[model samples]
Target: MDFTLSGQQRDRCASVLARTQTAFPAGPGDHQPTASASAYTRAEWSRLADLGLLGASVPTAEGGGGLGALDTALVFESAGRGCADTGILFAAAAHLFSCGMPILDFAPPDTRKRLLPRMCSGELIAGNAMTEPESGSDVARLTVTARRVADGFLLSGTKSFVSNGPVADVFVTYATTDPQAGHLGVTAFVVERGAPGLAVGQPLDKMGLLSCPAAAVTFDDCFVPDEQVLGAPGQGGAIFQHSMRWERSCLFAVYLGVQQRLLDRCVEHVRQRRQSGKRLAEFQSVSNRVVDMKLRLESGRLLLYRACDALDRDDPDASLWVSLSKLAVSEAAVASSLDAMQLFGGRGCLREEGIEAAVRDALPTTVFSGTSEIQRQLIARSIGL
Candidate 1:
């Protein structure tokens, strides 16, 4: 498994990194900003679109660059290193998940023809709505229901933690068509923003990724035409499972970039800072701590790349490998950030240096996508333990 990037992928990464560095420089005074406000930079978003970074995974036939998972991960990692802004990267991922992949995978011919072109152009923001208030990881227990109407289905219930929720133009949502049939009864639908009874709730405040606005969406007898159903009515669970496999596997690529950035800062600080007439790196303990940081970052990167390769090849162990990657990358990110703060010492605790902000940003890694405990359980199940 060669982890080396192809020349084209390397060039793309360099291009994205240059753009991100200019657009999202570190600000003053622990002054992190959420992406929801007018302060959120759509100019950067538009720049990414213009660079064709937004649709790297979509096929060329669908107006994209036709890159694969590895290429997409390279672009995401570059973005992460350049900007700690979670909102922009997560929004891009959400678009690929809800719009790009699904349209390519399951959309009827006319639906795909209508939606894919605009999505590739970045004119349409898309979201995936799966988590209900009561049913998050336990997707089988979701209570959102869709009863059949004359032309389509009447969708009713609420979905929470929807990424790109507040401003998304389309939602790839799920609901139960038969209440008693469990997961098999689930169905997927594409709900347009202005559908008769669809409403975007107020954005939820979060600990980290403040820039990525997340909110609840309510469907009050929302009318979804038959044409909007993603696949066959009973196939929603399969579609969702497939989506999660990709999400859990690849979502951490950008976070891995963040880990690399944090590691670099630690290395720079230790090389220059002094303690008791010796540089920080001269102290064995300090040097060992930095070594640990480097170790974690490298290991996490390997796991992520391994997962990406497995996904690219459609390997049988893809799901298991992805679970391992997600677990390793998320935990390593938090650990590396904490180490960065410690290495920075007094300056790290202060908000002005941006170390504290990195710590705050890293806090969410353990909870989102899937929790550490959940990942362990999945790993256990994979090995038949």
Candidate 2:
């Protein structure tokens, strides 16, 4: 019931924000820069690992911080506040919530002992491969298939828009084992990058979050041992849903941080910048827009925390709150970014100001982690409409 952070939690949040700001300082020249070689550098990944952020949600036994869902959201929010490059944060969230959590929860102990530590240590990276060309939001339409083999399975399919795919050491993907069984027939597997017949396509040219590399992954009879199978057969649906709930509830906190940062910048700008010999803050229209931004930021944070709390308590209605939080935070991010851009006048349109980049980054928030439309549909369905 209490939303206030404990002193220890406050210290963790401050430490993470300070470290992230130090590591990824924002500058005028730093706007919209593309990753030339790798999606993210090993050194950067190591820094996050050093901060214990990469493993914040992981159990201590698995070489992680063992933080719960609410604490994990705090970590992400702080990171988002400090890190100018939301791409890396986005990539890390995908790794933890989408790929790593499912494996941590559903994988066999042997598999966990083998991979989780490395993943937590930043020695290895993981990617989630669920979306396909024909299947984005709809899991039942997936075309990927996995055939049983002697000691393992043969997977044949292509997964599109896979975040961190280009550099991932392992992948948690889903494929149909019994097409007739529909969603129940789908199975999940943890496939290594070195698995035979696994091919990663060139990174997709993206509109924003350029530092987070996404690619299409093709599995041509890829071999996965029985030990790599996540849970039992026909369990992929549940596993995917479990990971997605974590993602939808916790990962969206990053946007909350981003919006906070944007709000801070806009507030400072309005106070300092003058128009017609008056501070921008003195203008009713300008001040009202800033007020709206503040309102959205605070409101979104409430929904986000509520969802995260529900997740921590294992509430049955957690999905509803998660969807509400996701939809609110995402749309708020985009709206606040636009308000920031407009308030900045011509400077916002310029790349050097970083405002335009924020818009581009915010644009996709509604699309990923389940689209805003999908979230609305889920919310309505939950309400018995």
Alpha-carbon TM-score of each model against the true structure: 0.94, 0.98
Score candidate 2 by lDDT.
0.90
User: Candidates' lDDT values, in order?
Assistant: 0.80, 0.90
- Mark the 10 consecutive residues where model 2 has the least summed lDDT: 29-38
Pairs that collide, model 2: none
Given candidate 1, what's the lDDT at residue 18? 85
**Per-residue lDDT tens digits of candidate 2, residues 302-324?**
99899988989999999999999
Tens-digit per-residue lDDT, 128-170, candidate 1: 8988899888777778899999989999999987987887888
Which parts of model 2 are misplaced by more than 4 Å?
A: 29-32, 35-38
In model 1, where is the ten-residue run with the lowest total lDDT? Answer: 30-39
Report residue 376 deviation for candidate 1 (angstroms). 1.7
